[model samples]
Target: MKRLLAAFLAVTLAVSAPIAAMAGSASLILDARTGKVLASENGDVLNHPASLTKMMTLYLTFEALNRGKITWDTPIVMSKYAASRPPTKLGVKAGGTITVREAVYGMIVKSANDAAAAVGETLAGSESNFARVMTQKARQLGMNRTAFYNASGLPDERQVTTARDMSTLGVALLKHYPREYRLFSMTAFTFRGKTIRGHNNLMVRYQGMDGIKTGYTNASGFNLVSAVRDGNRRVVGVVLGGRTARSRDAQMAALLDKYLGRASSGGRLLASVGAKQPVEVASAAADTDAPLAAAAPRSEGEAGNAPFALGYSDTATVPLERPAALEEMANAGKPQPSIRGWQIQISAAPSADAARALLAQAKSEGGTALKSATPYTEAFGTGANAIYRARFVGFDSEQAATAACEALKKRSYDCVLLANQG
Candidate 1:
């Protein structure tokens, strides 16, 4: 019954000064059998989703397959755009053709941006159009806070989501397409004579943890959405904005271990979190946490068909596991004075520099409304795992905050009005 829910951040820096080690954390656990939520914590807070966005990409692809719009053997050619995406990728050259089956494997196993983009373009004629469809699909599935800007979960300030929305997505993926969901459990697959392993470590290490996805961007932190099935009972769990993968996985495992039994036998109601009303679909234009230079391609036939053999380098995979000692580092810190006013958060960044840069671009795009607000960076998370949030903090009233965010949104920037919780 006791759950360490909110991840706290100190907020007592001088105005406009950047603070260190503050980040957001959110989670959701539900009984997959009954669609009943078991636990929720900051589940509605917007957080950078990272590669978890690919789950939607895969979902749409599965829809296409089922609709007969695409077939598994259909060719997914790597365009200049797809080939241009940064790695952890299968090194299919521009114009090189990989079957839809290979692309699916590349996505589930390698989390390849190129493969995802290829799938998007192949199905929707362009990634932007595909993203439009994605947003529509999200709205249909009740993912109101979610937005898509690209096929790949690469950093775009406009892309954002929440834990509850993702938990809903995970359930929808399984419930609507049980057959296609089986692909998520695949740990490795052979593609063009190379065997590629997946990054979802829980699929290999945890009991009944079949998988959904794993994501990381400096902005999003480590994220995982996983499902565990015990006989006829199943539970789905989602963790976002984790400081590290090992810590994230540990948190996920602890949640499943504690709740699986109860969920199996009908867990006590935590709270009924309903989805926001569906909105009309709007047209959309559309990494790892580390620099992708280390993600070089494997030479053909290098991997000797080992089950779960991966194609990425050590640096790309090393960060996936954090030292257990670091897990004890509490996110809670000394309380600081509240800003005591409303503000509009625009985006998140891995560093102060990035946060400042985003602020500049937002100001340029959001000329008038942003002019009155002071731009600042609030650090989220603690220690080396922290991320900086770009925000226009310091509004005297909630009405003022809402007005500013609405103005910014009209100009195509993502904006959320919120009161500071210092």
Candidate 2:
């Protein structure tokens, strides 16, 4: 009888080992340009997605914004159900309101479950209904093996996705919403007087990694979907069911190291994917949120002379449209003469003086490249929340602006080229 019991126990252990392994292991890497699978292991195995579900929620939000169903200033009121979601949240109370911009930052930077729920409720009127919409959208996007039961990736046996499906979603985000996709690279954003931070630490250490999502739960272990762009190469990598976040990130970094080099350096992948060309949408002036900041430390090979100051962040700008009256005020005391064509922005600063100082420093360091350019400061927002953009205008063409920007970059200045509508 003892021998029989031991044999039964041995059989049970053997049977459960593979099941456990399958439950907690899956990974895939793909070239975003060619859609070629670089490497995969159990990529089709279903697993919980955890907070990674917020990516889809944000995707739909971006779609809605593009469709004009909502704007950045649109308010998303939190229902009691949404506000009551578990921690890693913005903690907006029931009946409290946050703008669409804040909600997007909350979800992306903090992985706030409450923000996700509020966004879903605002979009679909109910969480269950939103789940259905999410599932339907997943199907539309060819995420065949994926399903979502909630806006937050809270535990639900029904909420499952495969690594391959996640890679598809990552690529879809980059292809379909190239402009909005930049939000994912943000590591922190100020919301409602509080600074909410993100947990995607790997992005800081790994060169070229930008916006993506990370997830974890007891059932899902640690999951991460990462997108990396080095020069002309781009790759999306997904790892699910890691034993810990560190291990998951390590694995992802290793995969990117091995596969990113092999990625093809074709032209814009968006063109090949048949993505709609991004159009310049009219910017709204009322949104008062601070610009999201990518706090990632500069990695080796990055061109930066000095570390960013305490309040200085990434050069990415929030939409800076000004109301007619405010626009007049911002341009006040400046000559409205002959600078036109294109512009290059160097930085956004907390105060107008700081912005001017940045422009002055850039002019001094920029050498002959910026000697003929006109320095301008554009102010946005109101009172304490206001930020100023330091810019150089008067480039004759896009190529001229691009050339100047390239020269500034080599000298370790962050630059963004823009068409001068004025």
Candidate 3:
């Protein structure tokens, strides 16, 4: 069984001992550049995100990087509260201070609880405060159903997020901070001058796996939030609350190939993981509820780009003209009416401040940039997920997002466009 370390726990070091939960159901998703959902099953049921919450933590940290609040060389002190946290930690002493870069590695590659706690302490004076910040940012991202009780995503029933929500977070993180997102690709991290390999076996074994994170906790089950890139194509995905680490990793590997294609032939790869279980990570979702049950047959339409976001809780936003690709559901309910017209996201920054600052810079350079928040922020939080989107909405076709993205890239902002299903 390959290590399917939860991305949230990857930051926390998965330090806290998990109570252990039952095997989770399985689901899958594929996407296009337009922020669409291609496939999913049982995606929405508010399952545990486990350590995946740390992904938000990393996102926040990346934002700080943009504002120059802390540099890679900045040392993060290990507080007493941080030291007191559970296992899967870096075990930093009270007086011990690790560089921001080291702390990031410990969180992503090692999933050090101590590292995540340090970030919480360094960012907001305490984990509780940082969690508040996280929740606030989550609201900004339109993650209406999410609540962060802890930074480490230890099994608090309240620390719930859906797969759809997680996907939203993943997309935001990738698009919001392309430069910083590379940190997720680190195959191994060096801490205390000792190198530890990341638990994300896919990065080591698979291709185009830049990253995201993996997580687990007793209540959250084995979970994985991962992504893959193929030339001009890129996609972000998540699998939460599985029976075991092996099952989660296997399922994700299979899913990645299904969407991104096999390297040899550029076609979908064979399913390496045998029978998949149901997915339990609601937080894995970014926006709306999961699709029908995994047992429900996948619609031929679900495999195509349909502008939509998944959520750990639930909400649906689609343009009536172009429906979103089918994804698993986070909960049971009628799909909301699609919002008409195009939804455009022109720019993404490591943080809202940085994004705004960049927009200011753009305006000075004779360009138009607008900053707005989305429901996605409520679920994921500002930690780069609640990106400052600069766009021109109300276009006849949804291509405005793409047009804006192309225009922004000319000025050197790596951009992607997102739209709604009509």
Candidate 4:
């Protein structure tokens, strides 16, 4: 009996060891300008990509746009299969349409699985074909160990990537499409009268960090690709197989902090690829401008109603409740309260009312983060060019203000911590 049991236990260990190895943590950091690997740990080990697969999906979309195969306004009609994708989706009905621009935002900010499927179909006639194209592009880009089976990066045993491959993709996006790359920095966007927010909270709060992507799934664990530009230095970092979203972000942040100072400066990644550095442009609309009509409600799932935070299951949406003091102040229509220590600005609007509207939206999404902070707006410029800065005040210290802004970013609200001049 002892001999038989020993043989059975050995067989069980052999079967499970490979599965455990596939889910282990991996990381990589690279200097974008010099194409130098600054740090790596199991960087080439294959692991499920989860939604980080959208990075390649967006890469192909940008390529098509650059090649004139599609335009930003091109309509992407949702098919039955696309619309039927599980939660964390845009919820467009079958035969319904969204512009290429909208689809891009849906994938980046909302991480909508349906949007990804529609874009894939539009580009390649089907998601499977798109996956083939994606893998081909991966080889061309030098990602030898990666394979993609779907565009949305949903659960697929056959789809896998590596930390080093993700960093390579991040650098490619920065180098080849400098203009469209700016979209990755967006924390939230107005979609059909509602704000579709993103889950990359670390990018919003991490100074110098711009855009990239995040992913999560039961099998893949938490994954992130981050790019940062500080002064003349630029670096791309990837972390995979984290136990939680917070831990994943923390790991990425630590990697950047450790290697950014060591990164070589004086050369731009886009310039090295002979790509023109496009001039940055600001949005022309005010915050209060009415958004387009919303699409159908998302399919039933806990993540559908929650802030789009990639793969975490605990980040459910909570109703906003204003503190009594804030309510009283709003009721009185009082002038900006004099009490202040530190402040945070969310955005600027064309009018005071517009600014106030922005403040309300921020508070609603910010939840308990901004509960103790006072809400107000301050005007700048003059005449038709005048703008009102939407702000929150009353934090007693810079640490307090920074903490609140970090929380707001986690909820997908743009935030900038500031010192109160008063």
Candidate 5:
């Protein structure tokens, strides 16, 4: 963490003490408990996000764990792709599996690129798919100024966000996933008997500091997402594009101190308490805004509505056909023989209760495949995550399914052929 404070400013014409100096850089420090902005510097200007991408990665993961889509104990299978991430990573080799509990640790403390990919793959079957899901969910969270191209915040011209948008994410993370959010406070994470200390200076040197994240790159400079709790009051701060590690941290400390005094000045920061009203969340219109696809109809007359996070501007309903459904496949006479090219071996939930979720895709597609869990949409505290499977069971030929899987993999799906005889 200290490294960033110095290295960041080496190239830039230095700014004086008592004030952070850097142009094209933006920052925000706010009251985490009260949601008040303390200091600001072009907080809304679009800039590269760097490793800050992982915060959302952790955010969506917490949601998955809470909803039972995954558990902390669940093992995350490392993939060749995940192992390919750049350094500042754990370097967990492909085919080695780590429990979700450990992956979070590796991500938080080590900032392991491998762990980020593992989490992305585990949730969406590929990082690309997960990135798609991330952007969709971000929009739903009212992150109008942001888009994510990957789980790791490597620079992408199109994958950009502003300080303001990140503040929304930072606060939402604390508000929505308190239990999981605390994991960010881990000053150090030990894995395989080795300790990887966190880079956030606040966790170690500052008072009331908790978990969040830090990001850096040639393009992004030094970025930190931080939260502090002083007594019953807590605040979140985002400092981006610092020229030096000390500058950023000191800047953060100074910013937080500045705001807290204002928040307590007259309790004016919380003055809007009575103005609060239920705000139905809506997504910033995509280039082409579209509405949620129609819910799938089951043979038993059940309506399976997948949670779609996209709130497009062009609301055009396809009135299209739901894809093949599992119930329909079972209802229709003889079970089709095993699909040759692509298939997913679905483990039925215990007591067969989880079958509907597993079969959600089949239900939505109008019974083309079998699902084991009830097909339901996953809603995090602040966003909706729809379950989407590009490859399901029962392809008639491996040649075609393999072709599709290959294509989907390029788009970030680690699709494998699942042979099901049952």
Candidate 6:
């Protein structure tokens, strides 16, 4: 299991505790460059993901685009099931059609439930099957704690995720699909001569914050996953269970301010008293690693280089064609994990500092299960080109170590078990 001491240290030294209005909230901040966990609070606790579920729905749509299975111009017809969804929808009538490109903006800007279901049905033939596919994709991305019951993320006890999982998904979106990820920054979109505004204000309100998703439901409260880029560094932050949109936005803004700077304590633990690994944490760790890339600082109100911008036009602009290589990036050069006993291995980093940041992030994501595991930085290759791998010692049996990996994966941390080769 990994521990989250650095996050606690950064928060304690840099900011005050949350106000009463934000009680029982959960949040996480991650370094997009190195996949570091900067700060977290109740990040692993289960909560409904609400409209944030659209992020995954869009992810699969992007996957389709990359695979050439669906083009941006392909039309998706609305079924009654899709059109009947509640408010915050595109209001397409049953049998009406919208292009894949329109569905993408509808989901991002309007958080339209109808557009989500239509896209899902177009891809998987049914909403339920599409959800199953979503869950499968989540697991492949290491989102063990998350499950999708519907494309719309409508109220369902079974549709749940953690702040950690959402942050990981946010990182994956940018890392795996840079071209499609640009849609999140759109502040508004025009549909049938009417302009629909987006609910996520972070893009306009926060300087560095660019694009991501926001969610709200009575049971889920207000939730948001924000992606911010500063110079060569990028950070993804998640807030779940906010009392209101205002409080949630404030909580996330404060976290971004305090943890995104130089205050991070890389090796600190959240609590002095450590707990032993529990049985549940050992079984479930598997996921594709996120890419390491330096992002240029974003200009105010500008995210990606995509030509699409907010405001209604009588004619919608055609989406830019993504490079053919975009799809293969998801599975290219993926290193195989150790399969024998059960030690957890996160991604390799090009530098010691990055390895340490990843190590801190892993510990925070793993929590109690990894508290007892010793941290080790193993170097691979040599000289200036050497990459360091961050690893945690394993339990005596594969079952325990495997359990621990599973526990971390559910929270969307990169963890793969290795057999003890003694």
Give the number of the best model, judged by TM-score.
5
lDDT of 1: 0.64
Count of clashing pairs, candidate 4: 0
Error of 6 at 198 (Å): 1.0
- Pairs clashing within candidate 1: 21-381, 22-379, 22-380, 22-381, 23-380, 23-381, 149-286, 197-309, 197-310
**Residue 5 of model 1: what lDDT?**
8
Please write out the lDDT profile of model 5 over residues 186-230, one tens digit for every residue: 888678898788788766888878868888888778888887777
Tens-digit lDDT string for candidate 1 (1-422): 00000111111111121222223889999887667778889888888778888899888778656744457887766777787789878888887878888888888889999888877666544465456557656765777677776777988766788898898788888877789889899999988787788889877999888879999888889999998887667888999989999999999998888888877554432222343332211110000111111112223211111111111222111222121221121223423223445656554433354455556556666656666676655554454444444566557776777777776655444455554433
For model 6 the TM-score comes to 0.59
Global lDDT scores for all candidate models: 0.64, 0.68, 0.55, 0.68, 0.55, 0.64
Off by over 4 Å in 6: 1-24, 263-422
Residue-pair clashes, model 3 = 106
lDDT for 54 in candidate 6 is 95
Evaluated with lDDT, which candidate comes out highest?
Answer: 2
- In model 6, the Cα lDDT at residue 142 comes to 71
Candidate with the larger lDDT of 2 and 6: 2
Q: Candidate 4, after superposition: displacement of residue 361 in Å?
A: 52
Give the per-residue lDDT of model 4 (tens digit) for 375-413.
775444344334445667778777777777777656534
Task: Give per-residue CA lDDT, model 6, range 63-181, as digits (tens).
Answer: 76774556788777777778888978999887688888899999999999989987766664456545755765675577767778789888887788888888878878888888888
Tell me model 2's lDDT, rounded to 2 decimals.
0.68
- Model 6: lDDT to the true structure: 0.64
- Residue 90, candidate 1: C-alpha displacement in angstroms: 1.1
Off by over 4 Å in 5: 1-23, 264-422
